[model samples]
Target chain A: MKTLALFVVVITGAMLIYAGHDLPAFGDINSPSYQAPMTQYFINNSLEESGVTNIVTALLASYRGYDTLGETAVIFTAGMAVMLLLRRRER
Target chain B: MSRIQESVIIRTIVRIMVPFIELFALYVIMHGASGPGGGFQGGVIFGAAIILYTMIYGIAEGKKKMSDSLDRILASTGLTIYAATGLICIVCGGMFLQYRAVPLLPDPAEVSKYLIDLVEIGIGITVLAVMISLFFDVSPPESEPEEAEE
Candidate 1:
């Protein structure tokens, strides 16, 4: 059973690596995302538009603030779930 | 205390290092708008400082510093701050999370810069509180669960 599991893992890994060959090289200018107009717009105007020097911060907190707000809620929910499940009651 | 935690050297170093680590976390959070670090990373670092303190000083001592009630409040407060910022935008006649809609500053971009910082702070607080509470919950209870300080 262990050998069969290992065989499955190895085949899956090999298939993933084989499929990775089609990916663009890191930071390739010709990559679809890099060539997109939105990407260019963000890169060029994030600082002036958002007044945040860090483009990632500008994107997260200003451009996509709703998404980040949702992420924060998710974190809060996880904490609450852990507390509810694990907290010991006082005797 | 365990032999390792009982060490004078370890205790002294941790005591000295925790404040600095927390200070660095604050720096990471505030500088996030201008630099590489952000709220999530900063909060994790801040939580780690407390966890390290707990490891050496024991859970009871750690709890005294950040009581369970306080942790819950901070967690809620951070989320409130984030949500409030968005609500304020709507009240000011703009879409949610729309920094320009806030009329605090003369320049919309300037308002955005400051609001971004405020939002980052909210994220940092929530992350810090949650991380610390999660660590407290998961770590094994000391030999005596309640106030076992020697």
Candidate 2:
């Protein structure tokens, strides 16, 4: 069992390291992500479009509001589930 | 916990620090648009404050501070706030979650910004409620009968 676990960990680590090479180098301006039109659009217009200086916040809360809503619902569901599972009934 | 309660200095310091921790959490949530924070981060910090309170004090005392009923209400309220904001936009003849359609504000950008802040606040409330509730549910009061006897 120990050997099997070690083998699995080594294989996963190797796969991740192999895949890491395909990632763009640190802060490469000419990277594909930086060149994407959506990236440029968000960078140039996020402030004027959302009136928020923080690009990430504007993106998450305004541009991608639906996703955040779903996230909030997910947390609410988790809380409800915990309550259902652990709460004691009044006798 | 018994050791923690015995140390007067530790208790005093924690009591003082909890308010500051909570204040910082609020600052993070409110200033998310301008700085590097938002609902989730702030909510976690706020939850941490309560958890700290629970740790230093007892679970019973923590329950007194934030009862189960209050936790559920706050959690539901946050989700309601998020959904209602989106529904209002739909009623205004725009797509769901579209802030530009809301006519309360003049500029589209300004309206979007305001709605984003509201959404952030809702998210923070939900996250904070859920965290505290989860902690309490997982570690319930084990001394109910002992207290009842007393």
Candidate 3:
């Protein structure tokens, strides 16, 4: 157990060192996100589309509401599965 | 605490209060649009009313109101309705749940709003009913399965 923990620490330390070389500086405005893929349209359009004030809520409930519904279904499926398993008789 | 006993005062209060609880649940469901509480929250609260009623009354009474088959219907119907509604958009040339291309009544925009709310209500009903059903299925009165095994 002790050796495994030490090995994990050494591997993590090396990985962190490698990761440090590739990350962008904090809050760089000149990145690709500043101009491309039209993030502004969805951000601006969802409020108008949903007629709701909260942006994330509008995006989640209206603009892309179906995705949220799918996620909710996933939750329901999971809960149902847990119930199904728990209700089974032991062999 | 022990089960609540029958008393004139308690009965009178419960008689008046239960209707209000049910009414409030409907209000939450109907007014989900342009409000914070939507179908999910409303459905949960609505189910809570039934669960509470059973607690106050008895399991037999609860079963009379909410049955096992009803639960299966609620759970299955909700998912089916959700998928079918999304499929409408796919048929209309947009992605799933793409309301813009949903192709609706004379004025599509206004109709879409109403339709979406209707869908939300379906989701609420299914979720709420199934949750209550699951609760009852797992914990039916005093006959806990684990106790029998012991």
lDDT of 1 at B57: 88
TM-score of each: 0.93, 0.91, 0.69
A59: Cα error in model 2, Å: 1.1
Worst 10 residues of 3 chain B by lDDT: B141-150
Which docking class does model 3 fall in?
incorrect
Every candidate's CA RMSD: 3.4, 4.3, 6.4
lDDT of 2 at A51: 91
Per-residue lDDT tens digits of candidate 2, residues B1-150?
467565889888989999999999999999999999999999989988887787777788888889888999999998898999999999998889988899987898889888888888899999999998888776646532111100
lDDT of 3 by residue, B35-109 (tens): 666667777777777766665555666678887677777877877777777787789888777666775765555
Scanning candidate 1 chain B in windows of ten residues, the lowest lDDT window is B141-150
lDDT of 1 at B103: 95
Tell me which residue pairs clash in candidate 3. none
Instruction: Give the top-scoring candidate (lDDT).
Output: 1
Give one digit per residue, the lDDT tens place, for model 3 in A11-70.
999999899767666687666665445667766665446444445444655676777678
- Tens-place lDDT digits, model 2, residues A1-91: 9999999999999999999999999999989999999999999999998899999998998888989899899989988987887675632
DockQ of model 2 vs. true complex: 0.81
